[model samples]
Target chain A: MVTETQQRLDETHAAAAPVIEVRELVKVYKGGTRAVDGVSFTVAEGEFFGFLGPNGAGKTTTIRILATLLRPTSGSAKVSGIDVLAHPGEVRREVGFAMQTVAVDPLATGRENLELIGRLRRVPASELQGRIDELLVLMKLTESQKKVVGTYSGGMKRRLDLATALLHRPKVLFLDEPTEGLDPQSRNALWEELESVNRSGTTMFLTTHYMEEADRLCKRIAIVDEGKIVVEGTPAELKRTVGNDVVELQLEADSPNELERQRSGIGRMLEGFEPVAEIKSSPAGVQLYVSDAAAAIPELVRRLDGDGIRIGALTMHQPSLDDVFMRYTGKTIREEQANVHFTGWY
Target chain B: MIGVAYETFLLGRRAFLRWARVPGNWISTLFFPLIQLVLFSQLFKDIIQLPGFKESSYLAYLAPGQIVFAVFLGVSWVGINLLMDYHNGYLDKLRVTPINRISILFGEMVPLFVTCAMMAAVILVTSLALGASLVTGIPGALGILALSGLFGIAWAGTSFVPALITKNEQAAGSLSLLFFPLAFMSTAFVPVERMPGWLQVVNNWNPISYVIEAQRALMSTGFDAGLIGKALLAMAILFIVTQAATIWAFRRLTA
Candidate 1:
């Protein structure tokens, strides 16, 4: 009975709806620790959004709230347009959560672990095996699918855990520090897999302290600190706000006076250069903030050639997410040591 | 309710597989009781000749108690499985699913019936191999296994309540020891008549004694509905009390 115009309007409206929406969400732990404080953000459907912060920065707390694993103390969170608190059951159907800790049965085979979760998620019985086989191949776990997870490597366990989350083809996937414990190679591999998953049209909401991870994966990121987000933007936009790329010239100076002389000499020579925004003296040599360090470096070397400023080394690097984080939070992310407690039961 | 049952069935299969794949789980559970069955039956061979004993051999009387002992051993640390899930974040993973939350608890509980019954059967078969008689035969053996499984479900609360309250596996494990004295005081090893008068009075109210007595009746005598009914009544009361507390504790922990 619907007209063509009305059907088109409905489709447009559905496409415009945000998959994840939050407003002033707060979660205070039992001892009055405000884990998530007044956080709000929205993710459009099929977007790869991330929360970037150090440990205990409420990233996990916020993701858990959105995942409906922990109830927030105040404010609202909606996943796929359903309120998380009012109807968690419905919200759960639209989302998959890959927790920081890998949760898989060690005694069960990889296929068994996936089947158990797939059944619980109500994946159709008829298509379950075919779906599992597809995922197993995608995850590169086809050979190990029949082996118990206890015998699998750490990276294999993580992939299997992720595959379990992906079994039901949720509209959104919430990954909390998905690569926290992976080796560099495994982390890169997981990042590629995550990108492919997002390409298949699942919105990804990831939380991590890894700057490279956020920079590479997220279309937009919110930098969180002390239970609140300090800034939010696309990765490139955030880095742009931190200003120019840095080009450091390690001058070959025999004494402090020579170093200071060469620093001022380089600064005076580059004072009128169009690419140079600011110049400063560093302990080793001169540091220049330039619009594009790679393009400006040859001219800079030419300008300093007649001044007896012998450059020991020249290094030009773009401002990274770490720079953006430092600009906003006034601190770098410090990797904390993991504490192990002996419960004596095992 | 149907949803809960369906979810419980799915999760219970995982729980059962987890137990069956680990040979240590059943082996350690049966080792203590099997050793006790073989050692106690021979050590107390002449004790069956005592005035209060009506059995032909000590092995026949010892078999039922050992069967219950196997069931008890099977469940003593059962709560640790749930605690492991909590620590490892499997519970959180399950919570994120759309299934009923209580299904996680029931998933754990439902599997105990099969495991406890199988563990009891091992001791039962072992006892028979060692020359114990089942006077009522196969039906009686099935009855004894049914009682053992129910007792396992009822008694698991002793481990679960502490585990949930303390959130500590060691505390749950050590707290189960506090119930061992109750088993010893029951007519597990000695008849009520051989105990002191005050002990005999306590045995009348001891739920373990009722279960052991019902199982003993099945093993040594014909089907005694009176004894079976008393055992069922005792276990029903114990099941109601423990399961109610367990459900409350589970709700609190999950909440």
Candidate 2:
């Protein structure tokens, strides 16, 4: 028996607002080094947002600021519509932080750690044990719950950490490199668990170096570099921004002198392909970005053959999060990761 | 407010559970100062024979000093625990919780205070067993132990600065070593008047000297309000300064 005007008002009010909002956030260290340089983004409710970056790219700093663990030098952040700086205690109640490093007490059992955090978070004592039991089953740590954290494996500990973060069923969860050092199986298991959590209508903000994790798990991603976000979009949209397919062609050079000439010729030759949108070249090979890789390949080989350029090797792939990262950061994520030197207590 | 008290209670329990789970941690904090007590009293037994010494039993004179040493040593270990928490990301995790920050610090400290009290109680009993009677009786001895616990808290406040600044257990270890020099420089082993004039001037400036003298006064004569007030003032000043430093350290750490 609701009137049309009343129904419209209800619908408007029911629309989901962003669970996380950050604007022009800056964090400068003591020596005037900006760890987070005016970074900004928003995470809509129930969206699994991924932050991809190299080490020291300020991803962790931004996460820390948003989590209310570290204060920002400038700008503003809001969690669950509450101003983080002004009401951090309120913000904390709405968000859960699982740090990059494992934070469980080594002397405490898995159940004890969760129980302690659950109590600190003010989960009702009546519901606390049931929630812990549910989390233990969800994290697949039921059998190991009695053992102290020191006895748990790396994967088990990470699961326990995630369980701790989820104990209160926070509206927004911030996970900083949640599976950094886990093996493939453990990483996959954790990812699956996280996916189920996100599906339960929790807003997720995670920072990770793993492309597959971001690709498979995150619905949207922001690539941060040198303390600022270089690009942000849905996974499909971001991959589309850099073209759908990557065509890597190694030019056959008869001698060392011809290598440079052949690379440039191959690069110029691929530029005229109708389906190709961008071309990049290095000493090892030439890469072409194409809208339709299957349509461009036959035409691509024809041009190379007609130009008298030998195709030493040719491979094509659907553009991956890796290509999107490389295109924005000017280096492969792996290369950047290798060059990163971690110093101090981090 | 209730939430903070609840969190503090849980966190304090966690700290005690750490001691219970690892008996070695409690053992070391408790027994290390006991060894120092026995060694110093036996070695400095002849110092009381010097002129101007009022106590017939040197152990009685040294008992208060040993209690101060034990409490200080036990309390300073809080720094090591805090440093470990920092390195392991436990503090950062805790910071994200809704619990009050002051609760985080005070909860961690409650167990250390307990350790200090236990160390003092054991040392007091040992001194009594060695025939060192308190002129003011058991009540006076309890007062002395309570004062030692206060001093332990002040000293622990100072220790937090180094722990947060260096963020290493080795730095905490080095700071503990520094405490030994401070202990020896004071009248812990001898009366301030018996020391050289320059050393006595330095001891007068030492907060530990006030604590030792306060405890000694309680044990040797009776409850002297003047001595206790002076000791309390010295400890208050030290507590204010060191607690300020510890708060600054917490700021730098979170910053």
TM-score for each predicted model, relative to the true structure: 0.88, 0.87
lDDT of 1 by residue, B45-109 (tens): 99998888888898888888889988988998999899999989899889899999999999999
Residue-by-residue lDDT tens digits, candidate 2, A223-302: 98889999999989999888668988877777866777777777677665678787776346677787888886887788
Q: What CA root-mean-square deviation does each model show from the true structure?
A: 5.3, 4.3
Pairs with steric clashes in candidate 2 = none
Give the 10-residue window scoring lowest on summed lDDT in candidate 2 chain B: B109-118
| lDDT (10s digit) by residue, model 1, range A1-346 | 5798899998997678799999999888876778789999999999999999888788888888899877889999889989999999999999999999999999999999999999999899999999999999888999999999999998999999999999999999999999989999999999999999999999999999899999999999999987899999999999888689977788899999888888888878877899988776655786667897787778878888977889999888888887677667756675321322122111
Candidate 1 residue spans exceeding 4 A from truth? A1-15, A247-316, A335-346
**Residue A134: error of model 2 in Å?**
1.7
B91-147 in candidate 2: lDDT tens per residue? 878888888887777777666666677678888898888888888887897797788
After the best TM-score superposition of candidate 1, give how far the Cα of residue A320 lies from its true spot, in angstroms: 0.4
Off by over 4 Å in 2: A1-16, A28-34, A242-244, A250-260, A269-277, A290-314, A328-330, A339-346, B1-4, B30-32, B129-131, B134-141, B166-176, B217-226
